[model samples]
Target: VGKIPWWKEAVFYQVYPASFKDTNNDGWGDIPGLIAKIDYLHDLGVDCVWLSPMFESPQKDMGYDISDYQAVYSRYGTLSDVDNLIAACHARGMKLILDLVVNHTSDQHPWFQESRSSKTNPKRDWYMWKPARYDADGNRMPPTNWRSYFAGPTWTWDELTQEYYLHLYDTSQPDLNWENEECRKAIYNEAMRFWLDRGVDGFRIDTVNKYSKRTDFPDAPVTMPGETDQPAAEMWCNGPRIHEFIREMNEQVLAPYNAVSVGELSNTPLPSQVLPYVSAAAKELDMVFEFSTIRLGTGGPFHGKYLYREFPLSELKAYVATWQQWLEGTDGWHTVFCENHDNGRAVSRFGDDSTVELWEASAKTIALWQATLTGTIFLYQGQEIGMVNMPKEWPIEQEYKDVESLNFYGEAKASGDAERIRKTEKGLKILARDHSRIPMQWDASPNAGFTSAGVMPWMRVHDGFKDLNVEKQEGDDESVLRFYKKILKMRKEYSGLFVHGAFRPVLQEDETLFVYVKDDQGSEESGVQVNKRRKALVAMNFSGQPASLQEHDLDVAATLGCKHGEELLLVTTLKKNDFSRMEAGVLKPWESRVYLNF
Candidate 1:
């Protein structure tokens, strides 16, 4: 309710451009469409909109393989459209964050073109290029065992230069040599000036840590067989000079303005390694989003088997607490979210959806967890409506559209491994492009009211749109959208408790429920009392069957509010009045509940 710092306590809404809105009936979401929907974003109570890459590209990697860093992709819109959107967002007091893809550039980028033109070209050294090694028999080989994140060897041969260039991702995306001062300066200058000149708030840097690679380009210790194409852990990923480069870039570009910079850092360990990237002194990143939570069910190269991984409530709490402890101890900030453009919908990944009541509860429970955390929270499009991952029944071909997914499928087929084929199918089907890139189901009308005319959407909308569209949910007070609005309003109102409060776990022994309480510095007693009074207990019954709460040591159920007396603040499971009754309650699979003990 009081004045709040924009960076510390703002909710961000990530808009996947192609799926957001189709203004020109081009079947792809565009910036103008987003501009028209700024009010929709504002009404949702989101303080920021993180638009996925809109820079010019061939769309091979969905604008991530950027050809032009400064120009808007024609598929999305023109430069004026972005300026208009920025103006609209600023006018409404909502900040706009652009995706900064500086780790690599599209093969079509002029710099890359120049790099591959000739060995002595001025831009040749701007990218990581090394001569390929050959055996006595003239057998060609890559410089290292490094693998591309997409799949296969990280180094791709260039005939003109007679060398191999490093591409941590798709071959079409060549890694820029950040070690080259000139190259690093150019990237920093271009990325910083582009958005800053447009009055944009900041950048959600894509793979900031990947910018710096070891000068040796060593191979990573093989973690998974056949997953060799990924950047050798030693070759890239938190390279030696990452911290220095980030700090320099921050000093020169990010630190000048009061901007909010969040880094998209993935695959790093906790405590020692990941903490430094977000510390205040680093001045490089205002916040960092670690993807461990999103990568739970995934195995191998992320396209591996889902494995039906079960994340016990205790483990989830520990993961949250570790970051909480780190953030509290250091001068660092964290970004939190379960779903993103690259991740499958959270409800389907972490919860069950056999029934409507259960689905809504699961969604609300996840929202409660995300909102209560001490970090900048992100709510991807359609998450507000309790959208789940795409069902396996959708056309497999349509769903398996991403280059990575297609490549894995082809590899599995070629290997003649039936088991691998099945796993690949299930993995791709379960967490496919279709899951995250589905059309925005605005209403129940034709095409879910996304567009007026009869036209094929870039991807299929969930069939549940008839009953799950925005029009229907917007009016229902208990709908996911309304619930999220309530949660956001609550977060804004209790920003003190949620933002600066010391996070402590409650019901530490319970594996089925995740409960935590945050106590403001001076308001520890008041906060405990408030939580207890408000029935502030946050619980999620992880078990398919209901779980009975058990009274534990003082440390177990850390009381934040009035002492627990006759009734518990909240009980996610449908059990007896007393949780200690030893009787199992019905959770109906992945259901969550929050009670106010006041």
Candidate 2:
């Protein structure tokens, strides 16, 4: 077949800078610390590194609230440090992508400062400001019924000017007005060009879909009853002019440098709703990160993301299949990820983390599934080392650092009830973002070898770090770290079958098995006929008990037009077993195997 784009075949490793490594011994990770680990990343087989926001900010929301577009955060380092890191990455044949957070800037930003000075200021139109609405009883009310993602009303009343500013996140982060032409131009020329000229690769645009808002500023229709009502995201997310704004960004900045752009799309209801944002013909983003599959186990809409419940295997399969089928022939691409800075660890959330053996097997199973998919795979920091969630026994006040979780705790505490507090604690244990923000486990030493023992980390290291650390697993052939390296290497070796092939589900009805095949057969571009094509089968057992499957049950010959062979490319079983027994339909608990069929 034909060669694909670099992004299409590349594997991206996401680094949450604060938790990655610390070089200054200040208990916080810096750019120099990340540069020191370039060799570690290179050996891991990732082609690109996507760093979270390190831009100058007050860090109210942990760098999401940007105060300066061109400067670096003091805790991270200086511009020269960023330049050195970029050079280091390129020298090692790896690309670097920075986080672009233009949706809103910190309230301390000069632009916001000038805009709020007076109603007639030149920059007044840059941000959304409106007069409050007063009821007949003479009580002042927000202009609309919208609510922020963090908590409270979306509009924050500024007493100085007697006007309310719209902030979809924290009140300190005021949303920018994209309806203004000059604002869009400034972002493309100043903010975007500054990074592109620095020789950095691309950007992972934050809140890319929420760039536009309804001009009318109408009240959002309530979907469910709740104490803390949230604004209907449909009223704002993927707004009317979102496409036009992204296209302008692409045509003016990203396209000129041949850079990759991936949008973070939240509240996207379906695959079709996301197609336009990333479609090549639309001249928008190169890809997008959708959360439909990630939200499967959460309590639907009414309850917040912190509330978790059981999810069925069948439902998970169907959710993933929808995206796979919708984007098959489209120019748009998808991003495959299981963990990030804003979510819980994958092994703890989706896999069985009850025992060490189960954790290792389940983690490898997840890695195998993500690697064989037909899109870019994102590996979060510490994911390669099989990191799990924080201990459930820790109290929120002592362990949690995220604003969202802390705010929720405060709101629940106001109830003055013990049961409510207990429930909130349980929910936080299951789904708080802090679970993934722990320091990366490098060694068995104090502080997980992330920082010096004299300095305390920004967040507590997971208690299990002593047993599940990089130093202990790096040399072990049976370690999850080695399994990740092997799967990544296999993707490079069999790029034709795993990277460019079409995915078809197998044994979809099975309760304990999630099986699929990636086969490149009967393609017009292939010189061989339909009967002589390459295929690979990926079968995974999601349960804790042994499962069996017969040759007739898999129907390998009927699906691929060839009998299954005896080649086992990868297996995630800890038991000492013979390979020939696989054909006899004996699969150990949590075992996953990938077979190459010829």
Predicted structure with the largest lDDT when compared to the true one = 2
Poorest 10 consecutive residues by lDDT, candidate 2: 521-530
Candidate 2 lDDT = 0.82
Write down the TM-score of every candidate. 0.91, 0.95
Q: After superposition, how far is residue 209 of candidate 2 from its true place, in Å?
A: 0.4
Q: In model 1, where do residues sit more than 4 Å from their true spots?
A: 1-4, 222-231, 302-310, 522-536, 550-558, 561-598
Model 1 lDDT vs. the true structure? 0.75
The candidate 1 region of ten consecutive residues with least summed lDDT is 526-535
Per-residue accuracy of model 2 over 1-598 as CA lDDT, tens digit each:
4445688778899998999999888889989999999999999998899999999899889899999999999889999999999999999999999999998999998989999999999999999999999989999988887867786788999898899999988999999999999988888876788999999899999999998998788877775456435556776799999888998899989999999888899888688899999777899998899887777666653335556677878777776667665677777777888888887888887788999889988988888888877667889999998898899988899989998888778777886878767777887887788988999999999999899887899988888888999999997887899889988988776665666567788877677888888876423232223444677778788888877756327654445555555444554544344455554465677888777754
RMSD for all candidates, in order, please.
4.1, 2.4
- In order of listing, the candidates' clash counts read 18, 0
